[model samples]
Target: MPKLVRDRTLPALCPFCRAEILRPGEVEGGEWYDFAAGSCTCGAIFAHDPTARNGGAVFLQALLMVSGGDMDRAMELAEGVDYDVGYVQKYNVELHRLEPNSFGTLYFVRLRALGGD
Candidate 1:
């Protein structure tokens, strides 16, 4: 007789509402886990699915390409995605200087564009 096995992975939590996330499947063209859940208590549907690569790097690259490397326009795009222009500006300054870290790249990018890289 063959033994049965089960997959055990901790459920992801929603960032906006702090609710338990229900994994549907892999995000389209993304390796990170994708989750869906009921509307948040705050009346907002929160969806968080990060890409397989560095988000910040991707975001910076896109912004540079779209805005022609204009920091001010990049800030505007960031604001359109519900991201704080100040925060994007702060990080972009470092990114423009060729800083040596890819951390928070995705977050910065998503917050800026609200779209995948």
Candidate 2:
């Protein structure tokens, strides 16, 4: 089984109240905030993953998952959100890790569009 490398507790703000919403008054990253989970004072479930190493990648995965593996839908969502992931030069983005005997994972993607135009 894959072990949990680490866990942290940050802050989660409330959308309606415009204040930090905590499971309790005082908390940290994973304790108060979870990348995979989020709740606001308004009781809204937010999918903001502050712990994510790459926000863009996380957003892409989220879009794909929510679209039920529909690439077109995911692309549409990405375009609608204005998170332009530059044209795919070449590379296969796999959501899974390679086998032990497989080569290393190296996916080349151009994120320059993130800057603009």
Q: Among these predicted structures, which one has the highest TM-score?
A: 2
Model 2 lowest lDDT segment of ten: 86-95
lDDT of 2 by residue, 14-79 (tens): 333445533322113333122342234333322332332445654554344344446686566544
Candidate 1 clash pair list: 55-105, 55-106, 56-105, 56-106
Candidate 2 error regions (>4 Å): 1-11, 14-52, 78-117
Candidate 1 RMSD computed on C-alpha atoms after optimal superposition onto the true structure: 13.4
Worst 10 residues of 1 by lDDT: 84-93
Each model's lDDT: 0.33, 0.34
Q: Estimate each model's TM-score.
A: 0.26, 0.28
Q: Flag regions of model 1 displaced more than 4 Å.
A: 1-8, 24-52, 57-117
What tens digits encode model 1's per-residue C-alpha lDDT throughout 42-61? 33232222333444444454
